[model samples]
Target: MAAERRHAQMNSYSDIELFSLATQFQPANYIELLSTSSVSTLVGCGQLCNQNVKCRTFDYDSYSFMCRLFEGAVETGSLVPSGSSTSLVGAVRFQPNLFAAFGQDCVQCTNSRYLICSSSNNNTCQCPENTIWNGVKCKNQGYEDANCSNNQWCRQDVEYRCNNMTIIKTDLPGNDLMWNTTANFSMCCSWCGNHSDCKAFTWISSPGMSFGMCYLKWSRGGGGTINPGYISAYY
Candidate 1:
């Protein structure tokens, strides 16, 4: 079922076909291009390009798997043989109002009920507060009290307590920055509180693990199930 869902998600992106051999195009503009880690396939590389608002064209290395995304157009006259397996893959441009296809408008997104759109984020639609984007849709965030084992916090409804763990129904949207591996419960809470967008946080500690992993979230939606090693809390 998971594999099926992933395949379906992959199919949702615009198609990109890669060239057979290593090729190079004239360096268009250094200021408009950014390079990042290469994905295993051209499709994966294209998805990355499509997600970024600035990316217009891309070059992928078949051997090293390095992906270079460009914001401007590719010059055909610059195409030459590099003698390596690096190839110029096709590009896929997403809609300006990325959420329009998802049944939302950019103007409506600017209201306090939703997060504002920005060019830096490629104009992607963000889920509203207390809701999570579950790949295809947004859903509500649920909560529950912790079991109170292994130094986990027990919730006290009346009095505010520090370092207490409350289970959130979904994993927050967006990629979580690894705050620190050696941070304690209090430090993790402080880190989340300091960040304006951090709505919730989770800490994972295992017996054999050297350090716990802290995940600060922006959106409060679709973590499917609770793991025994995880302790989640909201601000």
Candidate 2:
């Protein structure tokens, strides 16, 4: 029977192997893709923490999938082909110290009823009273946008919304403070990524000024204190 064949396949791999297969089936499910022009090299390890994957996280740098196979699950003589222009490279092997117990059948392992999700922080999702970690899994709360930004807007001292939805964050001149004149959204993000003081920011595509200005601000909603600050514009 079809059901029996599926059951047999499920029993063959340990929980970790099953999780790896799940991740392969949906690589983009929970990842924060920072791609420009449909391609990027900088991949985050945190992606696995957000997905149904139990194996070690990997980074894909445009050309290759840099896999961090869980200590022992990765074997010697494992072929990781690297392509050149179009030609493919061969296999190289290295033994990892992890064990088969580390290999898993579910992305999450249920201890009685508590589910262990990731190696990071030993992040666990507990089953509610009578509920258990059955087939459905727990997801992030708060940020509900297509991108999980947690719905909380980056409000400046003045609440300035561009086109009435994109909130504008303002910056004051001081130590560790950063603000820059940028032409568009991309430049604004670049400015924020380079600045340490910038936790989140916003920019007006069209402002009174000739070009737009990047507003560096605090990340209070994710859990931080708001301080008295100044905004150059009125909300």
Candidate 3:
């Protein structure tokens, strides 16, 4: 029964270490709390998450026998006390290496074959070969995390632009993150959000500077510019 149930589910994460071990979370703090249900085991809870593309992580509380599915990547801040390290377990969704065939049941790709699913043998997910699973569906490689410059994958409607990079306060400096040639404003934007002192940042595109430039700031500075070559935002 267990194998039959697991045979149809798709998964995102393989490592338990990627999850938050010290703290538990609440629905209000997350970007979106997708769903909740009573489940029998940790694997059962995870299956629910694998079935949903919008779920970034699944929180299973052994003490309560309840599963929580959330949208958006899990973060550490604003955690609620759930007591005992063994009770509430969180699983961060990763990019899957297997795929479900076209018209195959993505929700049913739960079989434990790792990379292959065959319809003839009664497999849950039907795939031509091993590839990448974008949580809910199969996706081609290199396109899992959306490119911020080309398209706002996470926040499509919003983009901050213009300005030279500088801190709002003279006494503080932004985080020590630097720019990498392959990364764009997306990663820089993430750095600012995670930094303790960074309240804002200005990311100059490759054309604007010699390479991508991320100027982390302690606060949003008074600005006046109309350059399409850069992006600025408050963390």
Candidate 4:
């Protein structure tokens, strides 16, 4: 029975020492968390590393035995004990090291945008539909740049050649990017074209980057380089 039984995670806090239970079946992203429960439950934020398969490390309340599913796995010093007052229990909270967990132990991901190295094969990224794979990451619309910054924008025809492709917005700070939506690169370009202060743009597919949404930015402050294919038109 021990050999076949799957492991599940649970947490314990006593006299300032914490103990984590082992688990098998991992979660994609802490999908269904009932944070308001009487007990506190937490999961790691990244996938399991060095293990045979995906699993999560979790911590539950003193008397409970439920594994909290993080986006992935737990790191050595990642988990933290919730404060006595705050309810780490029923309220859902994301792990702080979520992204780092995905990039753990990676030696060659310094310049790669979304390429995560795993023990069992490398990670797969969700790229743009019109784009193709380029060994490391995804490129849009037949682009072939080493860092995904080459000819990112192309001639959408003469009168309206895409201007300043592959731009980033800083007007609203962090409000420019969205994840997990059904918008396409063309639509994203159009949106940038219509905005008054939009000086440049960068667009990536959803799911892998930021869910399924596009990130739009307005840069009143200049001094940034532009991609080669754009027509130098201002929005």
Candidate 5:
């Protein structure tokens, strides 16, 4: 069930099938999607999409607890009308606000203060363990500082990010500004974050990639691509 259970994800900054999650959600028009722990609440769905650089819009059903993500920047007015259930709702990319009808609130805990509702305790308002929503996205508590409880100097800039299941092919392939090798994604992240010349980093963990490989680039290389087990992020 690797393919089926492969979709199962633990909400975090990195960790997702960034590529294939699309094919899985396409035909799921109105049918009840097979239950997955990855997306339980509408907020979790939004969070999943938020972590992806390609996700431009998202659909959520409060009643069915289903989330559909789209890569196109679409307007809600032109979205596919929910079949028979009035519980479905869609929102623009990066915009959390929505107008629902014949339905219920997508999240019970949505405000400037609380962005996540504990799945263990639905009524409870709190963020995932060790993460804090940094206005635009949820980031490691002390990712860009030296004052972390562990005192880990993860990064010196708050501009750092981790994009799971993503890839970045540096434009300067022949230049020393780019390189690839077998290594841990976090190690690559840490290296790139600390390297003055590094601007983006990518990692892939799969059989085809010899378990995992880190790809580092010194400059931007356009948008991300769908690569299974690939994790790409820029600062």
Candidate 6:
């Protein structure tokens, strides 16, 4: 009877491929917490696991109504039965795009790029830095003067322009500011653009200086400091 009930429950997950529903099975590692809600059924638990990119398996506790998501593979000997029955759902397949066939669900690309799953039944990879996704791969977009053309640098509505040797500062003291050292002026612009809160940036370099410093500012107000060693831009 218990087996029949489990089979009925598993059949409801037409989209997922269930591994097992043992009495007390648990996955090896817990990568992240996807979601927790008033889930009381195995199908509900399976749906939660399927929606998360990082979740490979899930364990549902009937008594506490808790859903735990896990990543990685389940070991052979790790499925031990405990006193209570914990439904373990595992191994979902994902079809990212028409070009790529069904593959194991993955949270990220193997090359450390961000995974973008589309609602149009496709999934693609994105490069976070100043890189371009050339359909098949990611390539360096390069820098323009002191500005970077990477999509990750600025928001969709914001535009950043580069100046060779200029600086803009505000009279308002204690404005949120951050500074970091970069290999060159181009990297300084790239670094500043990557930040969501960065409204403007300046790259500073003195005579014979090999490396430059990037200053990220919250505002683009003028009349504060103008120096020959600084190049400023706004986003």
TM-score of each: 0.34, 0.22, 0.41, 0.21, 0.26, 0.33
Candidate order (lDDT): 1, 3, 6, 5, 4, 2
Q: In model 6, which regions exceed 4 Å deviation?
A: 1-14, 31-37, 75-77, 94-235
Misplaced by over 4 Å in model 1 are 1-10, 75-78, 93-235
> Over the stretch 1-235, how does candidate 2's per-residue lDDT look in tens digits?
0110111111112222212121211111122222212223222322331132333223233344333322111221112332322211111111121121122433445442223434443444342221123234322221111122222321112222222223323433333245676544444554565565665664443323334555665552332233222222211
Per-residue lDDT over 115-232 for candidate 3, one digit per residue giving the tens place of the 0 to 100 score: 3445675544543231244455442221112232233122333233223343221222344334344234545655666577877766665542224667777766456365545555
Location of the lowest summed lDDT over 10 successive residues in candidate 5: 26-35
* lDDT, candidate 1, 1-235, per-residue tens: 0110111133454434344455743332233456678589866777777666445567777688777786543421124465575565454423333334333445556542223354444664465433344455433222222123322122222222234446453434445655565323434565677787877777665444434667887755556456655656775
Best prediction by TM-score:
3
Write the residue-wise lDDT of candidate 4 on 98-161 in tens digits: 2333334556443323334545544432322332344443322312111133344321221323
Name the lDDT value of residue 177 in candidate 3: 39
Candidate 3: deviation at residue 51, Å? 4.1
Which candidate leads the pack in lDDT? 1
Better of 3 and 4 by TM-score: 3
- lDDT of model 3 at position 220: 62
Whichever of 1 and 4 has more TM-score, that candidate is: 1
Model 4 quality (TM-score): 0.21
What is each predicted model's overall lDDT from 0 to 1?
0.49, 0.30, 0.47, 0.32, 0.42, 0.47
lDDT of 1 at 176: 67
What lDDT would candidate 1 get against the real structure? Answer: 0.49
In candidate 4, position 102 carries an lDDT of 39
